[model samples]
Target: MDRPSVRRLPRGRHALPPERVARAQRDRLMTAMAEVMSEKGYVKTSVEDVLKRAVISRQSYYQHFTSKLDCFMAAFQRSTALLERQIVEAAAGAGGPVERFDRAVTCFLETLVSDPATARLCVTEVYAAGPEALEHRTAFQQRLGDHVADILEAGTEAGRFTCRLIVAATATMVSGPLLQGDHDALRSLGPRLVAHVRDLKAAGLL
Candidate 1:
């Protein structure tokens, strides 16, 4: 009798270990959701679209996220974490308070321009999602403000800056335009934004 012919698994069909498979599925779903949300606003994108894009079934999708909004929230949180890392890295090793603030602003604006989808989702969609979404956004904003306030407090103690306005002003300066969604306006104000940060340093108000 002829030796039994060996069979090969189809391309991209090789079995993955259970943990790897689960991780891969989660990643795929997140990526698909982001793409869908970016192309169509959060309100327009649906769970079915996410499943189709991810090529995962409804059962698999539910296993990962309770709802489409939940998935968007998770994606938004991940984006923010990445953005905060970038801002911190960009500001690291700066010689002065002004330089550090400038680096942070530059990193933030560059991130917005480089990833407009993230900007849109963060700047626009979250608020549009309604009260619960706004509550989540407010929490994030407060955390960021607190972090900036800490930086400002440090600069003041070191005599690198000297003003009580640092906390609220810095928070507003960084987040105001991002919430406005006017790309042209932001671009026009880019130089002014840097100058304002520098002016704060000069006035010891950082």
Candidate 2:
């Protein structure tokens, strides 16, 4: 997916509701936070940087988030939620389990590559946000792993464990390539990763 635009409203808006206006500004701030964090890393990013890119006022930023980390988590959660939805929707399509699994994995990697800024926030920079981010990451991994288990009809505990392994290994593979800016290599790994899951299942592992 493309990055969300840092769009603006007319100088004197007329018809848009208050809630709509609030959501638009929040989206811009989150988009700016993702992009700025991608470029500068979490430690180096400041509230001013986000406000600058978002073209939003400091007062507006405070209405939604208390700190830069709060903004970062908001963006992280939003981006990952979208990514998860894409995966689930892909897996829900017309196909057998393996095909659905492949579709979901392909969508996952393609999403990461298509929007590197958000990908960086979701994949790499979350680690820099401390314990709250770490807990969220763990929960995300477990939920995603469970999705994979569901795709494979893995009702047993062992099957779920194997799925967890798959998600962890897949994350490792993509993270290195993503951090290196090797987007082609990152996209190419999707098929191989899917194939690994197939191999594991074929061996009666999952």
Candidate 3:
């Protein structure tokens, strides 16, 4: 999705606090990085791409990030953190394991579809950034799998593997349709994924 533009400060000094100015600038930079990386992929994106998209100066980019990889990794961290948090909350509160699992699966799919730019980076572009980025992505998926294992009260190795497998698979399912420009098909994935989860559970995989 296209984020609203960052409101620029006046050409000269303004009343905004230095900290607030810095925060807004950083938001612009990260948002821009997500946008650029999604469109161009990690290997193809450049510092200049982000600079132009963010309307922030090259010097400003350096102050916040050592390089494009650094910025993209930071963005990856931010996006995955939020996704995990949302999933946790969705699985929280008054519900049985089944209900909580449903909520989580639904929320996870919805969040990705709702934010295509960030989803593209987290799901696909990370593979292009080499081992570190892939490790971070895999590790987060592992944690998310463990969390789901806790939700399902299935902390066994088989359970963990199944949960993580489905999580990773679901993400791939999304990236395929998204890359193909089939967003309607992508949005329709939740029910199908949940159905597959049910099959997995029935097979004693969860």
Q: Which runs of model 3 end up more than 4 angstroms from their true locations?
A: 1-5
Ranking of models by lDDT: 2, 3, 1
How many backbone clashes can be found in candidate 3?
Answer: 0
Candidate 1 vs 3: which has more lDDT: 3
Q: How would you encode candidate 2's per-residue C-alpha lDDT over 75-194 as one tens digit per residue?
A: 989988888888998899687777889998889988888888998898889999999998998899899999999998776899899888889888888898888889899889878877
The whole-model lDDT of each prediction reads 0.64, 0.89, 0.81
Model 1 error, position 23 (Å): 1.9
Q: What's the TM-score of each model vs. the native?
A: 0.75, 0.95, 0.90
**What's model 2's lDDT at 159?**
88
Give the least accurate 10-residue stretch of model 3, judged by summed lDDT.
1-10
For residue 100, model 3's alpha carbon misses the true position, in angstroms, by: 1.8
User: Sorted by TM-score, highest first, which candidate order results?
Assistant: 2, 3, 1
Off-target runs (Cα >4 Å) in candidate 1 are 1-15, 150-188
Model 3, C-alpha of 24: deviation from truth (Å):
1.7
- Pairs that collide in candidate 3 are none
> Candidate 1: deviation at residue 81, Å?
1.0
Tell me, what's the RMSD of every candidate? 9.3, 1.3, 2.2
Candidate 3 or 2, higher lDDT: 2
